[model samples]
Target: MEGYAKLSSLISTDSEFAMYRKFGAQNTQSLLCYQAELISFGDDLQQLAASDRRSQDTDKRLHAENWYELSRVENGKDQQIKKFDKIRKDNCLIQQTAIAKLDRLAPYNLRNLRRWLTRSAFGSSFLYGLEARAWDEVYDHDLLAFPRSYAENDKDALPQLFLGPLLELFHNLIGRLYKKGTTKDTLSPEPLIRYYDSNILRVADILITIISSGLPIASITALNYINRTITRLVVVAVFTVTSSLFLTFLTSLRRTENFAVTAGFAAVQVVFVGTATGAGNGGLLRSDV
Candidate 1:
């Protein structure tokens, strides 16, 4: 239900979206370059783990042949290597950690990414940007796609996940469209992109208030003349489902959390229906007297 201004004006004044549009490529490149570094690091770790002089190989020889002390005295083998076994523990830890880091790195899929980003930004309207960057040489990070898309699960980080697609989509759609449009008009600054999360939170708070308090009384009043029992149940059910979906899409609530909120919402509606119905019935009975 967003109203739109003149198309030419919109094209001219939209600056924040333009910034993000430009940011998409740089962020994607930065993300990829950073991933390349992580891959190189993991590969190097694998090489170190694979080398012949690795700790595990030393452990096997030391444990099997009791070669803790080398035949050549200058080799300076650890006489207590088998007894302490710290080297093997260190080697095991390295291998385990390397496997974990490698698993986080997935093959790049621009197609899936495009779909996800579009979906997150409300079918290419360019609502808000995400914060997604997977990793780099100095840091390995998790992917975070809230209201996560299909390709984006619990993993993924900023710049790569959110900001990347959000910006790219804006550029591809708004940026491209603006160029062909008349130069005399431009879209104004986009507050939606600038204060996206805050706007979402504010809307969420308002929705919560409506669902918890307003809807209950409204439903009762609307359905006051209907078959009290069946109509109230239907109204309550509809409110529950709609609110559940709203929370799911707009906020990052889990299924259980949504359920709890929905349950409370339904409870209020049920209480309103019962109390109002009872009061009406009592009034009618007194009138008969």
Candidate 2:
């Protein structure tokens, strides 16, 4: 009775521990509940950390990709700019070179006509003929394209007249002197000098005025000879032939001692020489002659 009374008093005093005192049931239940709550909180924290890590990785990847793309675009643009700059520089250099060349040529070109006039009579006549022919060709070409204006009309004329034909004439004449078939040095300076004195300067001045006034000379077509190889070799030949013929005719007339015969022979010689000289100067003399 004394033991039973002690046990009953302990149980009544500790209600929470009453079951544990007998079998530990209530204490175990409370411990299990607290453990479950702790586990749930730990799992919640781990999931939150994992989600944060993934979000940071995605942001980093996006930033890196954007930087790479931006760099590529900038590089491409830089290449294009460099290409354009190089092209612009090349064009500028070409333009500058052309301008420099043109400037260097101006003085020589300006003096050509005057220089040719002073060269020799044959040279002057030949050059004058060449100039006239070139002008005619240019005029004809311009007239074909713009028929309303005459060849003398500057407004409708082709620029080729001023640029191409004039330039070509000088080039061709110089080239002819240097060519293999013609022994230019063998030519007697006397006839050329005489021809120059008689015709070259005046013709050059007249040509210059006509060209400046944009008028085609009436004599231009008469001067422009056709392409003939023999024509070039005949000038010196004609001069020699005419002098020989005149001397022979004079000797014959003096021997005959007849005034009428002498006059007739003289007239014949004059006609023949005049015709030969004209033909030679006009470049119409045959190469075989």
Candidate 3:
């Protein structure tokens, strides 16, 4: 009976041991399945991370491309603006040249107007002193050339010959002034009137009358035209230089903006690299591990 009891105990213990082994094997299989699932989840997460990285890279690439395209567009726009501006400026310069030429051809009565205005005002009287010495010499010579002797010389006969031409010249000038009505507005102050009290004007007028009275009308006219032409040439040169410099400045500004866009794209690239590297280095391992 004791032997049978011992055998039964041994069998029970063996059965329990076998049951424990079976349960352990089932648990091990469950753990293995859980590990496999975790591994699959990790694989999925890795795939997602890789996909996110690729997406980010694609986004960055697209952004960079967009920036590059924008830079190209800006550059093209800048060039176009410069070209259009140049054309417009050239047209304006041409118009100015045409106007200048037309002005040169138009013959306004500038000389006649100046003479009439100067004569009507006290400007002519201001110039009387300059010829006073020469007039005195002429009067003295006239007295000596009188028909009668100096003892029989009459003041009327002596002075009439001397003053007649001078009075006639004054009357002729006065008649011209009378004919010139106040038709036109004053363009500039008359130099004769402005300098009526100036001794310099008398001195200059006397010198000019002595030196230039013998000059032909044609020579005077040619000299005046030369002076006018030189002034017009100077105006045209200034306009051309100013227009060219302004255009150059505008072109440079546009080019600078275009280059700035390119630099912005480069900066974007740098940021993308830093962000991608930082993301890769950060912890992205499976939580299950």
TM-score of each: 0.38, 0.16, 0.18
Candidate 3 runs further than 4 Å off:
1-77, 100-108, 116-289
Per model, state how many residue pairs clash.
30, 5, 0
Model 2 root-mean-square deviation = 47.7
Best by TM-score: 1
Candidate 2 segments exceeding 4 Å error: 1-76, 101-203, 207-289
Q: Choose 1 or 3, whichever is better by TM-score.
A: 1
Ranking by lDDT: 1, 2, 3
Look at candidate 3 and give me any clashing residue pairs. none
Off by over 4 Å in 1: 1-76, 79-175, 179-227, 248-250
Give candidate 2's whole-model lDDT: 0.36
lDDT tens digits by residue: candidate 3, 82-141: 433444453433433343332111011222222432463412322345442322323332
**Positional deviation of residue 15's Cα in model 2 after best superposition, in angstroms:** 99
Better of 1 and 2 by lDDT: 1
lDDT of 2 at 110: 26
Which ranking of candidates, highest TM-score first? Answer: 1, 3, 2
